[model samples]
Target: MAENINSIKQKFIIRNKLGLHARPAAMFVKLANTFQSEVWVEFEDDEVNGKSIMGLMMLAAPSGSIIYVSAKGEDAEKALLALGNLVEGGFEEN
Candidate 1:
């Protein structure tokens, strides 16, 4: 009786000058929280909750670093698209 939900994962590079620092991390978390899906960010060997500001900051990813984003839930695809756009857009810091 339950609907099917799939998880989506995608890779993105940190294009922002400051990378995923406090500000950008905060923005990521804020946008992530808006979705009903569960979000995660992976950098190197570290994976953290995408909705957690502290967790995102702990990745310590710098500009040009590679990160993988995963989302699972009803809105997984949408979440990935928006997050991908944000990162690809350099967090709009420029």
Candidate 2:
């Protein structure tokens, strides 16, 4: 199977009290790196590589902030779903 630019995208809200901090950003990067696709996260006019910890942290998405996760490649769909779940689950940082 050839690797095509099959993109997938999802939007998530930061409802966690702490919002997107280092720990959660780390988790997000870790998860983003798991897929054989290119992943990105966007907030406002900024977009960063989802697999990059520093890049993710630069977003500074606080509580009630809206973010968009997108991926493109062979596993784009899976990557998108996984990221969506992670964000929806608040990165499990209760």
Candidate 3:
């Protein structure tokens, strides 16, 4: 029988000076692609695929913006943790 792993979800706040700009958006997409799970990000009532640069850019999430993230698959937990850490780390641009 196949193993069952439910999706993992969490909330994060942008703490970087640039927030989720082009470069950081690229970073998020890159990281999202590294995992086997399907990742997504949400702002307010909108949600976007975590691996899509255009989707993330549309959010215009600036510094201190709160966002929600969810991942589902084999690496769901790791994906959530990594994405959360990436945001909390401020993209290391500052």
Candidate 4:
């Protein structure tokens, strides 16, 4: 039998100067693809697939903008936490 997974939603702020730019979006996509879950990012009224670089870019979440992340699957919690950490850590930039 397949295990039931729950979905979770959390908010985050962009601390990086570039916001969700190409490089960071790519990174986010790569990270999202690592797990077998559905991940999405929401800004205002727009929602984008977290695993898609183009989708993430469309959000144009500038620095200091509040964003919402939601994930559903076995790794939902872990994925959200990791992604939250990624954003909070400034996309792991120097």
Candidate 5:
């Protein structure tokens, strides 16, 4: 499935006052679930499942914190770009 293989890494800064807390994390998870790719988030040395709300919350991504996002699979490029947009846009400014 090499033709379907795709992946990308990007960093985004949290601009929302609440950071990437429960609501935003839930939104992210929901959006990510709509895709058919493996998505993940990384911060410093920690990495977590992008579709796991609990796992995302554990990151404690505070406002202005830079986070890394990546995706791989059939729709990895779209997924990663969408997620990066979400984070960069601060979850649509909540």
Candidate 6:
């Protein structure tokens, strides 16, 4: 039998006024790099490596856009939870 892998996926709405701009994208990439799981983010028809700043910027998601975040690896669940919180929390904006 093939070994089972942890794959977690969740959708989040961009809450920040600026959406996932440079600062937020950098923050997201930084967080993703700290995880052992492979992360991917999707917006509309565009999906990119969650750990790549350029890839994230390419999404060009605006505020109120829905995004799908997925992670496949041992820490997939934790990754999704943290990423979801980040999205929901408006990237910690006041």
> Which structure among the candidates has the greatest lDDT?
1
Evaluation by TM-score, superior candidate among 3 and 6: 6
Off by more than 4 A, model 5? 1-4
Go through the candidates in order and give the clash count of each: 0, 0, 0, 0, 0, 0
TM-score of each: 0.96, 0.92, 0.93, 0.93, 0.91, 0.96
lDDT of 6 by residue, 23-45 (tens): 89998999999899999999999
Best candidate according to TM-score: 1
Cα-based lDDT at residue 24, candidate 5: 95
Superposition error at 76 for model 1 (Å): 0.3
Better of 1 and 3 by lDDT: 1
Question: Which ten contiguous residues of candidate 4 have the minimum total lDDT?
Answer: 85-94
Error of 6 at 44 (Å): 0.5
RMSD of each: 0.9, 1.8, 1.3, 1.6, 1.6, 0.9
Candidate number with the higher lDDT (1 or 4): 1
Candidate 3: what lDDT?
A: 0.92
Question: Scored by CA lDDT, what does every candidate get?
Answer: 0.96, 0.89, 0.92, 0.93, 0.89, 0.93
User: Model 6 has how many clashing residue pairs?
Assistant: 0
Native RMSD of candidate 6 (Å): 0.9
Q: Model 6's lDDT to the true fold?
A: 0.93
Per-residue CA lDDT of model 4 for 1-94, tens digit only, reads 9777889999999999989899999999999999888999999999999999999999999999999999999989999989999998899773
